[model samples]
Target: MKKKQWQGWGPGEQAEQHYLVEPRALAGGGDIRHVSEFLRACGWRDRSKPGGPLLMDSLDRSIRIAYDPFVHPGGWTIHGKATAHQEEWTAILGRQAPVEIVAGLTDALTRPRSAHAPNVWAPLQEQRWHTPPGAGHVTAVSPDGLAWMQFHQDPGGHAMWWSGAQDQQGNGWTAQFTATTPMHLVQSYAAALASPEPVMRPRGRVPHSARIRTTSVSVLPSQLSAWKQARVTAARAATSARNSWKTNRPRTTAHPHAQRGVRAHR
Candidate 1:
């Protein structure tokens, strides 16, 4: 069977350039013997026609076999640490490994290794979120991996929003929202509204229900931290109050005289 191969390119390269391999040929390649042994241990079979030596068609094909040059000497050090932790959990739980075990394993495997860990799987810390000035909300949508669309809420409050999606075509369209009117009427009115010179008066007047304006503000890191701390303090106070209320309820209900006094106040 043909093996899958991945190609990588570095700076100043016009085209992608790399090599290929297949598992059977690694037995003769000195450094690749370790990989061949690992595969054999994993019970991989050739599964070709019986009574013939497994023949890898080409050197290119033979070299396409499993090899991860990116792995460090510690052998995915973060993964090793995580697996060790998981073994501890398995030992403690002892034969009650639920579906959560699989989920925990996946989390361990996928979590970021370190602040400056080399990213072999995907781009590192590239995704970002930012709200535009005077906009109520901003969201990013990516259809292809390369490009993204930023949708912004219209601050003018015409009950409309705007977004621009770029394609291969150079010229893109700008869409604006106008009051719902017949297309012909809208066109004729729009034409009339258009200035013959620089300054022109309105041909017909249209009434709007209300005018809307948005205020934009910038928040500092200290302000944001303060706000978060305030919220946490408020939440803790609320929880304490709730617990106090719960504790007091038994005493209030148990004592007839206290209940009577409370009822009289109500």
Candidate 2:
């Protein structure tokens, strides 16, 4: 079967440009709007005023989302408190993490799930992420065998999974997701990471961090044009949807972040 790929881009160092297909999960790409707009579409209310932190919540108030650039590694912080109907969960995406990858987690939050819906380790296992016999952790080694990802089943203190990688030059990065985050979301993330899709990046900025595993290729003019068109189409659709939503929803406190055109990874 053909593999699904995640799309993303990164900066480069070379004057003569080329495309590097890397996993956005590790390289980090996409804009903040990818998250914010999707939330709005799912009936999340924006509660931030002008010049304040971006804050939003689900209609039922079980999930809360915050984006404060002032915070270290500022990206999107999501919290789900146990309510009469749901269990507690927490997820954090660093400022540089891929919005698409994070979307998998967010999208999972909007739906109903059972405890036995799916195993988080399934996708990773398909991609060769493994747990040693009698071991409590699962791991996937990169193609080059120098980088890896790991998940701890009983990591304690809410911490469930985390991964890190570094290049020979010593640059590196690490990411973690908390327990109770929903296995479906974790499965979505793992599936994307294990996907064969080539995340596009500039040759100069090929390795955004040490953990990225990619092969460099010269971008065809056709690919660039296609990418541009897809972006334009998506932007127009989002704008139209947002406009329709604003017209129908009851008025709430004004929020400027919901209206800003700022791109996430510009």
Backbone atom clashes (below 3 Å) for every candidate: 10, 8
Candidate 2 lDDT over residue span 158-208, tens digit each: 346775445666544455677666667777766665565666655565555
Tens digit of lDDT per residue, candidate 1, span 86-184?
A: 221111111111112112222222122444543211211133323335544543322221122233345685332222222343212222212221122
Worst 10 residues of 1 by lDDT: 88-97
Provide the lDDT at 264 for model 2.
Answer: 40
TM-score of 1: 0.17
Candidate 1 residue 130 C-alpha distance from true site, Å: 35
Candidate 1 colliding pairs: 20-63, 20-64, 21-62, 21-63, 21-64, 21-65, 22-61, 22-62, 22-63, 22-64
Assess candidate 1 and give its lDDT: 0.26
Residue 68 of model 1, lDDT score: 28
TM-scores vs. true structure, each candidate: 0.17, 0.61
